[model samples]
Target: MKQSLLLITVVGLLLSSCSVSKSARGQRDLFSGTWSLDNISYENNSGNFKSVIFNDAEDICFEGSEWFFRDNNSTGRYTIAQSTLCNGGDRFFRWSVVEPSQNYSSQLQFKFIDENRKDISGGYGYRLNIVSLTEQAMTLKSNVSVDGQPVTIVYEFSKK
Candidate 1:
């Protein structure tokens, strides 16, 4: 009876350990749902924070925007509402999370696609490092170039 009890305890310990690690990997699937932009900020060429005013096309496109991620698929939809400076519509894209590894950090990538799923956002694709991710919120950092100047954008989003 004592031998059987010891074996049971060891099996129980192994099962519990497996459960814990599997839940961590399950976090990758938690990205599904509609996310709304909470706010955005930028870092200038000098790597200093730069405030932005939303008044043009770029700004309007982000206003009232909603990102919808589907479970178990790399395709998603970006929805925006009509505004004075923008024509709101739905756009499809291919998105995936880069699994972090020993040699490199993880990031989120987006490749704009048409109805047929052809690449369109840019040939190279957009990559943003994930700053934080939780059940209710996510943050991403993107470095971009505008007019020969380097800039970094920080985006905070919350589930809707």
Candidate 2:
């Protein structure tokens, strides 16, 4: 009876692990496509909004940018092509969806890389809360501090 119980417990643990892996894979598959940044909004709505985002470009530049995600390799690129004020170019990054924990929501994290797949952010990365995701749309929110007040930058995307 003891051996049977142990076997059953082990099998249950293995099956649960497999299901979690499958779920993560499925989420990545949904993100494996070209997406257009449709809109960007502020949740806290502070007048003292930061102009720069990701320390790379102006927040306005990302509104109409293009993002490409490859689920198989966990690689992606984002193109900034909208504003004359912003330098238009492609930025490469390796991305992953972090599974949700008791204290945090499901997060989308990425680190900047070069064309040769080398790290460029000096071991720094960005994490955004995965607010919502669907076949046609996804929304991500990044929390920031401006003048000692918390602010949320919301990014909206549509699959293309």
**Model 1 per-residue lDDT tens digits across residues 1-160:** 9999999999999988655234334545767888997677776765544343222236436745898887566788877678776677877888877766685456777777888888875665667788788989988887777778878787888988
Off by over 4 Å in 1: 1-27, 44-57, 101-104, 118-123, 146-149
Q: What TM-score do all the candidates reach, one by one?
A: 0.68, 0.84
TM-score, model 2 to reference: 0.84
Residue 8 CA displacement from its true place in model 2, Å: 20
Question: How well is each residue in 1-160 modelled by candidate 2, as lDDT tens digits?
Answer: 9999999999999988755465667778888999999988888864745469899998888889999999877899999995668999999999998888897788889999999889999999999999888999999999987778778999999999
Q: After superposition, how far is residue 93 of candidate 1 from its true place, in Å?
A: 0.6
* Candidate 1 accuracy as TM-score: 0.68
